[model samples]
Target: MTEFILPSNANDLNFRHRLPDKRLAPWVQCLWSMGRPGHLTESRTEKFYPDAGASLSIKLTSPHPIITLCFNKTTLIETLDTTAPCLGIRFKAAGTHCLLGLLPEAFTDTHYRLDNELEPLGLQGLIPVVERLYQSDSQQGLRLLETWLLHRLESQPPANSRITKIVQAIGALQLPPQQLGATLGFTRRTLERKLKREVGVTPGQLVAYARLNRARHGLLATTLPLTEIALQCGYYDQAHFTHAFQSLAYETPAAYRKRKLSQIYKA
Candidate 1:
């Protein structure tokens, strides 16, 4: 997932992310942190792009920590107000189901406190660990979290190879949605049902996410023109790209590019 931080407030915020260790790479996407660079004085709003995954967020607060599970099918805009830093673990597309045994569809488009949710799975023990994680520095906390996730992975049954392969293919945008069933030796209907049950999205939706992810990076990371980025990302033209981007992101490509670029200039 990409975090869009406007330049005006960038200096006041401390945001960092890093990939997980190789052992946890298949399930964990990345670990992230957000907080004030100095004393926390005000709130900050951030925009998060859709990445077809779920995240576990831990906010360091008074008395006790605040923990939540966030899973969204579209862009998420949120404001943060905390004295201490917030930590998060972003799970891969099917990772929440593979590791936590939670149905992705149930948590779609919303966030919930994990206290009650984890109790049912006998994972309430994780609450304390999460609190400790918030207290630890980024390196120590990420290592501790990875160790726990590695242990959990050892106990859980292996993820379905076919589903994993399908997700990889879709994420890479190598397989067309229509050909997914044929390539995997399942009927289209069966494929759709299984994917939705496990991945929380249809194959087509996954493709859209993959394309958007690429286009988003292009707009933010490079100086490419919209027409060039649209064609490179497999859209027919700039208009198609703009419509698709706006439908999922609530902002047109040109607007998004301009806003992000303006931030860079001001920075």
Candidate 2:
């Protein structure tokens, strides 16, 4: 885990993100946590967008915390009631298969409890960390998690570096599925199978996420016209861009931009 940072808006939730250490960088993308404990008068629900990889999340305030293997989904509405805080270890696109000996596709659009799954996989000892986390600070909890993950790395078979590279390439170039196979020197079917097994989404889905992510960055960081942003992000037209953006973001690009700017002003 990383240092927690609260959002500037007093009414908003807290979100902290930290990059993994060098040794864990290949398998782990980053660690993140979010919460709204102080504002628990009414339950708050948030929409979470899809990303490129899988995440292992723990509901911190739960009495019996269960580690969940969460796969990327279309759009998810997460509600905070008694469990107002949560922490997650986000893995690289291929890290799930390498670390857990499981196909990412099985967990797509869903989550699985790791308690029952890890025991049979000889990973029962790692389950105790959840209980330990109840007594530890964020830094300590993250340390424990990394230690366990490193141990798992030592015991399990190595992850496929080639698949990792392919994922990285897709992100970097924002290549569409139809074009990705030719660039990566793999057939479409082979790429699809490997990504389904390791990354939990098809190449087309990954490309869509990449495009939307690019559009988001452009919206927040630059004053480019929506038309230009849409074209640059590979959308056929403004309508197409707006539809895709709203699907993932739950807001129009203009609205998202206004909200982001408002947050900046508040900060």
Would you list the C-alpha lDDT of every candidate in the order shown? 0.76, 0.71
Residues 1-267, candidate 1, lDDT per residue (tens digit)? 333333235465666677887776766788777673245657877676676788888777666777788875678988765467777788878877877777787664577887556788657657667867755886677777777777777887656767777777777777686686678688889888888988788888888888898898899888889999999988999999999999998999988889877877787
lDDT value for model 1:
0.76
lDDT accuracy of residue 175 in candidate 2:
60
Task: For model 2, state the Cα shift of residue 196 in Å.
Answer: 2.1
lDDT of 2 by residue, 179-263 (tens): 7676757788998987876777888777777777778778877999999999998889999999999988789999988987887
Clash number for candidate 2: 0
TM for every model, in the order presented, reads 0.89, 0.82
